[model samples]
Target: QVSSGDSSVVIDKKKDRRIRPSVVVAALRAAQQREPKFKHEAFIESLALAYDFVIASKSMRPGAAVKLLDVYNVLTIMPGSAREYTRPEFARDIYLLDQSGHVTTKKGRKMSLPASALTRSGGVLRTVTRNGQAKDYAGISFEEPGA
Candidate 1:
């Protein structure tokens, strides 16, 4: 059993090179049962790690903002590797992170994405706004979270 705080992954055999999908699903289900509110906790943690990487490199400053697209890139695309965490999926996670972040779908977390001024060519996220345009939450703000 490999345990990290409340999350635990128990495999019967440690030497097995190829694990079964059912085992993974079972572990995940157990974790969810343990804590249902933090549904998107992995997404939030990954985003925070990526954001910290960008900040540490001085691509952005302390108490400053980083582009959401950039964070997605750093998280998904490594120097010599690639991943399939698509932008639309990232956008959805971001939307949920804002809506039900702090509590079990009740409060929000410390992270925030303030509005960004976009030009005609500025990046746009499909966060599903009622209006034609969504004021573009193009960047993420760590300042508000007291970075």
Candidate 2:
């Protein structure tokens, strides 16, 4: 029998339970079916969509920020949406950017970007928090992606 945290199983004279390759493949297939396919465009679209909301918020309050969790919530709650931004792979995609760009997730009561970030014309994107918790506020001031 398999034991938790143990990679090797103790085989007895009467018990021989070996996992087959077919079993592994079947299990992987099932998991793949249950999860949404990772698409770069979909991930980018989600960010862009969240950026729109951030822009609106900034218009109301200068230097306002938004939470990444809020962006994930918005993407998942859309009607007829199939993209799953909650998946670790999808989430990791956001963290992939050029040297000049970065996404920050911090726990604090206040969130702000550096003044130098503002000079980019394309503002930096960051998630805001309050009381050391994420809030529904992602800050955006950067140029659109690919612009």
Candidate 3:
């Protein structure tokens, strides 16, 4: 298992090999199970590993745009587990990360932003209109729990 602080290794490994689909799914499931004790950090670490695995693996079906739902489906299929492992919030997190260009597929395609960047920058900004007035709206602020 990869340590939380060693995400760089995971990212680097993704660039070199084709990870197995089952390994990716297992990493995600492990992250979900460990979330309660380790909090979001566990999720982040697990996410990095899983993302790397998915991108490096060709078993995800060729030409199919990898989506968070696709990852979630794998999480939902774990055996002997009754807990809800998949959540829209988690999927959104993955989507935002992908949008940031930090993660990438095996084909050298970028995915999204790094979690650290999102936490430090207060997230992506957007334009919002209310009462015919347009204003800049800062995206959601993501902080690790208890931090």
Candidate 1 local lDDT, 40-87, one digit each (tens)? 667676777787788887766665667777777788775543334456
Per-residue lDDT tens digits of candidate 2, residues 1-147? 343354433222122234465764555455434533345444454565565575575463423444444455556676645243333332334433211143322211122323342334432343222223322222333342233
Whole-model lDDT for model 3 versus the true structure? 0.38
TM-score of each: 0.55, 0.34, 0.29
Worst 10 residues of 1 by lDDT: 101-110
Steric clash pairs (candidate 1): 102-107, 102-108
State the TM-score for model 3.
0.29
Q: Judging by TM-score against the true structure, name the best candidate.
A: 1
How does each model score on lDDT? 0.58, 0.39, 0.38
lDDT of 3 by residue, 1-147 (tens): 233453322321133132465765555455444423224334445554454445456464322334433344444557743144424345444443433444433334333332333334443333212232333222122222233
Better of 2 and 3 by TM-score: 2
> Which model is ahead, 1 or 3, in terms of TM-score?
1
Pick the winner on TM-score between candidates 1 and 2.
1
